[model samples]
Target chain A: MSSALPHLLVLGGARSGKSRFAQGRAEVLTGKLVYLATAQAFDDEMRQRIELHRADRSPRWSTVEAPLDLAEAITAYSTPETVVLVDCLTLWASNLMLAERDTATATEGLARSLSTARGPVILVANEVGLGIVPDNALARRFRDVAGRINQEMAAVVEEAVIMYAGLPLTLKSKG
Target chain B: MSSALPHLLVLGGARSGKSRFAQGRAEVLTGKLVYLATAQAFDDEMRQRIELHRADRSPRWSTVEAPLDLAEAITAYSTPETVVLVDCLTLWASNLMLAERDTATATEGLARSLSTARGPVILVANEVGLGIVPDNALARRFRDVAGRINQEMAAVVEEAVIMYAGLPLTLKSKG
Candidate 1:
């Protein structure tokens, strides 16, 4: 039986191997691989981290940088013969909030895009609400947004998995 | 039909409601409730936090502050007629590390104590490894140790749960 689903939401904490798990799921599909990156390299450390991620992908995979306008990027890249992997919604949410964009509108747009996407779509998001209540308002707001987005995505996705210590625990699955 | 377990390990991120869930679990047990707090009040903020936690518990519940000698405290307080709730091992781990106490030994001792404890014991720990790798060595080490201790606790506990968005997902259960 194939483990791939038309739409999959992979949730985990940082270094929870969510991206790697998403990549592995995408690799199982028989189609062109498209990586939609939401992270922006604003510092040297980030630049190096991004570079490492880029280096890990096979040359056959095409990359799309979508710090914002994630829905549009998904619409532009998704095809019946293409597997689109959005390697995180948490960063996208942060970007939208930082840009002062209405998150509800953005989230709705992304949801609509996912509903209409032509091929398999794998979305990754960090599980940020599992830690202690952040001491700052900004961090708390970020956590709330992230948690809300994860729930929204989980509701729409055909499959949902939580990664723990590099292991995947299926939270939901399509029959 | 009962959700409470004799030895439950509750793991979650900040504000993920792990502590609340643990408290609820403890409340359901039919015994004298005892709270074993591992957090240290090194500053005014922490003192306030401790006070708040203390205020949240029922006046009938006895509270024990054990920052370093957790195993000894657990041994001393746990009895057949008492339900001991340890509201976090992560802080205890930090305390042990900061005090230059041998973590491996302390962890082993704690495990032994849990194994032999007479009453029901509930542990709460932060799932710290689900995020991006910390930039500094100290943070990275803390994350590593926290993860290891969580795993160790999960192994010995009768039940293991990961709390997210105030919901508990059981990872392990007594068979």
Candidate 2:
């Protein structure tokens, strides 16, 4: 294990193995693992997916469902010895987009939370650009918002990984 | 008004009239108004502030508060005749940062949201760098995150405004 530990950003398309990759990284960092899940089981398929994820984890891992307050959750749960795995941000952004009264409120909240994260955080996100632009205005907007979110995350993170077909590609890194 | 309407981005220290300035721009865009507020007031102060903003709006203007889905909000609301004003992104970033489990999640969510916004989305963000570096790990991270958020927002935004002492300085502009 490298003595100098840094945050990790793993990006991939849907059904990609980014989550599994992040989980592996977390185990390497610490045994006291914290899984920060951003998805809410709004429907049956989602619930099943959540259940599968739950079943996959060992009882040793502590999981927290933080739909919006990521920074606070990290601060509240993480320690230098703790390894945090945030399953996905795309879903969280989608949830906020669905529920928030406005864009500014969500954006500001995200900015505030990121500035204060406490320990090593592994973030999982989607690569939305590879897909064709959606026909509807709302769909296109989701792509646009997701793109901006990715750019901001990449700017701050120490390392960025792009995963494709279950294969990981390191896009940027600082040692 | 000039055929080339200014795409103004009003930024300032918190409570430093950034929202008010953005509101003024909204007023100027009257008859063609869209107010995109990014705040989800979980506390009394924020709730009251939201209440005041609601009361302040002209009945003709359509209002939408999208916390995370900016692309959807902007596309859903934007029109050639419509002038979309996103009150603040700093808070949105903060919210995402706080709510997500780790930096990667926060960063990814943020990047996606910002890049997707459409129309004349006048953004508001906090300038967090003029002060001293935060003493602890969290504050320092927050500063770094906020700074990067601003930098990325400025890069994509057609125009950028920095408000200090209630003064608006045009940093970069397309018009």
Candidate 3:
């Protein structure tokens, strides 16, 4: 982790093509491609979603499931020869809530890991706070957690983008 | 109606400071400020929200309640000496749905009004599709409607921006 590479944070709403855009960026970089997926199949809907995402990726990428311990996954998988793409932080935030883990600690750990990452790391997150407030307490809490995570990761990364209808809007460009 | 000034579309999530930013822009323009408010007080919470928003503006802004017939209101209020600010369109979209109005026709009417408006226009809207799929069908339909309205308004406007925590990211710039 001596030589730190610039990290990128990709954010968008549902079906905004953020994951595809991040994958395209990762494919253009030179390294062993690694995908650290944070989604767990708790139901049939989620299972189907996971399979669809898996099918969307090419054979050049190896997958790792890190539903709760995402920070540790990043720390372990990041290498000078590897390019790790964490295909979302939103689900990871929800997973933390479901598992009753401390999110602040986890968020800090994740940010710290990115600061010393040996290879280029690309993170994807859903921008969930742009809509009307949810009726349920849990959903609102999830939105706050997800949004805070996005902000922290964006501050840690060298590049940040928000996607709309497959269009990338530069939020924080690496100078 | 002729001599149309360039229109602006401001988009953001809840508490993203879109309203304040749009108001600042309108205050800088030279004209009598007109606020086309689309929000209706259906309950105590909504009534309080409306009052708070009303208190946010100065006496320079004359408010017009246009919960449904926004296009007609724009046609009546826009003039060479006026700067019109439509506080929001998401609620207008909902109002259209609740009133059983044809959204496609309404959207077209709005677009046409902007084409030949006689004053500078600033429109605000919520970006509601960035979260997880709502569990209910009506909410899903609303997301689609609101997203479509935003996309259309964005295409028609000379300036388009998305607000995040009071920071504006330019989607399109007036040339």
Candidate 4:
């Protein structure tokens, strides 16, 4: 019955082990594992980060790079015998906002896709609003959007967990 | 009995409403309120931020500034009829590290002080270990030390709560 869990949302602050926890949860499922990465390698540092993340995953898991159009990617990759893991939603939101795309519409579409997904889906997002308010307008705006996105995704998921110091605290569970 | 609640350790990411939650929690106690601020106004922006925080607090609450000697400040200010709220320990840890003080020793002193405080104390701390690993050594070291301090303080406090997006989730409680 552990494998019968549906959609899960993992939320945490930076370096909070949200991704690692989500990966571990996905690994427990009995199906094809798909890692849908949203981070774009825009610089040398980011390239190295992407490489490091890639090295951490098992070779058996299929990797899909979807910096934008995440809803479509989820729809395309998810199957009845698959577990699709979206490593993050914040990066995807950033990509949308930076590209002048409508984030609310995009988020709604993603929610629609997740609602009908045939297999278990795990989503990871950063909890970025817990710190001091950013000094600049752009950063503050980013925090608001990212926070809204997390709330939306958390509302859609059947289970929501907040990761902290390598610990997972379940906020909601519908297994 | 709400007023009888003892020590509390509030943890959250930046701007995660930790300070606000701590202030609200402290207000509920039937005692003289004291706000122990640890931030050093090193620049104009910081000064402005500090001023804003000061304005948000009630006039009934007395403010105390302690950037490095948190244990001493806590010991000096706490009384049976006073509720002392330390805005943060992370900044205090950073100040100690920057000043070349022994953080472990300082943390130990803080634990000892809180163990015998005369009144209820509310301590705020940042959860800095959630996101991606920092790119530099100093940042990495700071994250490690801040996380360790949080763990130590959480162990000492009678209650520990993690603030997320303006909500307080109790991690531990003895009341």
TM-score of chain B of each: 0.95, 0.79, 0.96, 0.96
TM-score of each: 0.59, 0.48, 0.60, 0.61
What tens digits encode model 3's per-residue C-alpha lDDT throughout A33-146? 999999999887689879989999989999999998888898899998888999789999999999999999999999988876778899999888866688899999998899
- Name the weakest run of 10 consecutive residues (lDDT summed) in model 1 chain A: A128-137
For model 2, residues B97-164, the per-residue Cα lDDT tens digits are 77763544554554455454344567777776654444667666766666776777677666787643
Candidate 2 C-alpha error for residue B165, in Å = 34
Candidate 3 lDDT tens digits, B1-175: 1234479888888899999999988887777999999999999999999999999998899999999888888889999888889989999999999999999899999988887778888999887787666997688778768876887787788888889899998888766
Interface RMSD values for all candidates: 4.1, 18.1, 3.5, 4.5
Candidate 3: what's its TM-score on chain B? Answer: 0.96
**Candidate with the greatest TM-score versus the true structure:** 4
Cand. 1 TM to true fold: 0.59
Better of 1 and 2 by DockQ: 1
Ranking by DockQ: 3, 1, 4, 2
Q: State the lDDT at B131 in candidate 2.
A: 43
Encode model 4's per-residue lDDT on A134-163: one tens digit a residue.
Answer: 447788778768876877777678788888
Of models 2 and 3, which has the larger TM-score? Answer: 3
Off by over 4 Å in 2: A1-3, A101-112, B1-175
Q: Relative to the true structure, how large is the alpha-carbon lDDT of every model?
A: 0.84, 0.68, 0.86, 0.84
**What is model 3's C-alpha RMSD?**
6.4
Q: How well does candidate 3 match the true structure in TM-score terms?
A: 0.60
Candidate 1 deviant stretches above 4 angstroms: A1-125, A129-175, B1-4, B55-60
Task: Write candidate 2's Cα lDDT for A1-175 as tens digits.
Answer: 2234567778876777889888877776654788999899999999999999989887768889988776668778767677777878778778768876354556555545555555677889875543222346676666656655665666566777877678887766785
Question: In candidate 3, residue A174 scores what lDDT?
Answer: 67
* TM-score per candidate for chain A alone: 0.96, 0.89, 0.96, 0.96
